[model samples]
Target: MAAQHFRVLARDPNTRARLGELHLAHGTVATPVFMPIATQGTVKMLTADDLEALGAQMLLANAYHLHLRPGETLIAQLGGLHRFMGWQRPILTDSGGFQVFSLSTLREVTDEGVRFRSHHDGTDHFLHPETSIRIQEALGSDIAMVFDDVVAYPCPREQAQAAMERSLRWAERCRKAHRRPDQLLFAITHGGVYADLRRWCTERLVAMDFPGYAIGGLSVGEPKEQMFGMVALSTELLPDDKPRYLMGVGTPADIARAVALGVDMFDCVLPTRLGRTGTAFTAQGRLNLRNARYATALEPLDPTCDCVTCRRYSRAYLRHLFKAGEATGPRLLTYHNLHFYLRLMDRLRAAIVAGTVHQIVDEMTRLFPDEPSEREA
Candidate 1:
């Protein structure tokens, strides 16, 4: 029998969201959680201790990048991802299929796998389902993702269907290749924006009975409504017992809506990326630290925030750091942004238990109003 790694603890009567627990080899992570993206074994400017301090339960790393540089064999020799990165908490490794499709310059996709040149050094490389599983196993993360062909937004109907079917075939191979008892493997559902294809893929993945399911291919430049529609459709078809992960999604509004649709896990680089660019996520929309308006402001980034950045530094000081190109500016904002995401998750779980998710959602919408044109993460 497959391992039973997830358990629903509570449900919201007003919405599809539920409070759940994912029991992993490393530890237990509360559901509706936001995992910081630690791409290349690091979460940008923050340290492992900083992540823990920010209330992060687990983090996401890219197997593709790690495989290209340090190589998985070296990581295995160094005692795996957790020890190597000094993060003892649960870690989930993405199979890097997205990178194969999005990052590589020249690529060819075949039944065997994807053949591509490294974006870093233009070296020849190939990644199949079996090899992806092997790499994740070597990394020894608590959760591993199956490699799937991800099509970009505005894809043709025929091409979307073909990619979705191919992803299913690769999923089966990943299931057979995965031998680690400690690692829970997740299958990424791909179907572009086609509802029928999405349904077909979800039902098929459910039949395979992987420990979890991830909703992929949505945030690749699709409209907000279409993306949420895909998420809702996929969640409707997924088993309630297993966890659901929404990959590379979103702003606060996006996360809240996905949670209401019963998504259990989320990972995105938006917070750190925006932070590095002198932007901060706040309850009252985004704050631009580079703006001259902040130069004389003596307030914290967010008055309600309790993060060290908010507690210690004033807006003026943060602005000064950014204006002068000091590295500390990005580091401070990164910490605050991570804290905000984790705190948002904590509040969501509480709202689910209290059956007040709708209220929370409404508050988030009001606080973070959608702009006329918003970009995907």
Candidate 2:
């Protein structure tokens, strides 16, 4: 059977924020959801049970990384990605277009596809839209993103336009090439920071009428204001009935603001990556466990958090674990960080249903006053 459809349940009176559901082949996901990145079939140090316990409704994986490492054919023979990863919940597989552009040191882009060397072993690989669709089909993910041409931020308008046109053509190829009846394919909108280009791309994709749409090409070192503006514009042009995803974005603040702008889904590496480096996302903000001030501070990571790490461990102990180079430190922090992000999404969803989205947005903005540097996060 094909993946189920998206259902918008309630909309905020004040903002575009809405409470909805994305019915997938694996399960139904609550909207305004935050999908933890399991780029290589795992969320870093966490397990599937850990993800379920953290209230994760879905997960995001990469076709690029998985295709290179274990290869999709091997995974398909072993019962697809869900059984391979032990994650029975819904999974969204990215086409690796971003990875091909970002990770490959050597690449050539043609109207048909991208030819590049794998960053892992410098192995030669050619990825076209059809190849991406085929890989995701073999992986058997619940949702698949179309392969897109990603341009760097601050690119010339001409460059951005050319990439945008190419991405549109590629999206059509993905649409035609996709063969998995049980998986939903989502198209991505790209245009750098150019409004006209973004609108043009969105309009054309909407006309194609995929199951969902994702706003990509932002959050690549562009200013926060510019990114938000692009999100607003894209969401404004997208159909209200279909789910809208904001790709590779962002902090708690970024999620809240984007939700207000009508986004329904998000994914990022900040939580897991930061957690590994001794940082924890708290209700009060980010707390670095490596700081000396926490050397003797005996409080929980967050006074309000109920995660096992926060409930059973104190700041002092966590700090010690990191200082002592214990692997458990990163594991604990990763768990807590994912819990925080997932809980934040829960709060936002409830707020949308209760007509209190603005209040939650204000609170999140106050807690995360400034967006952390992407590299630092």
TM-score of each: 0.97, 0.98
Worst 10 residues of 2 by lDDT: 368-377
lDDT of 1 by residue, 253-293 (tens): 78888899999998887888889989998877789999999
Check candidate 1 and list the clashing pairs: none
lDDT of each: 0.90, 0.92
Over 4 Å off, model 1: 1-3, 371-377
lDDT of 2 by residue, 1-377 (tens): 22249889999999989899899999989999999999989999999999999999999999999999899999999999999999999999999998888889779999989999988898899999999999999999999999999888789999999999999999999999998888999999999999999999999999999999999998888999999999999999998889999998889999999999999999988999999999999999989999999999889999999999999999999999999999999999999999999999989998888888888889889988877535211
**How does model 2 fare in lDDT?**
0.92
Looking at candidate 1, what is the lDDT of residue 98?
88
Once all C-alphas are superposed, what RMSD does model 2 give against the true structure?
A: 1.7
- Report model 2's TM-score to 2 decimal places: 0.98
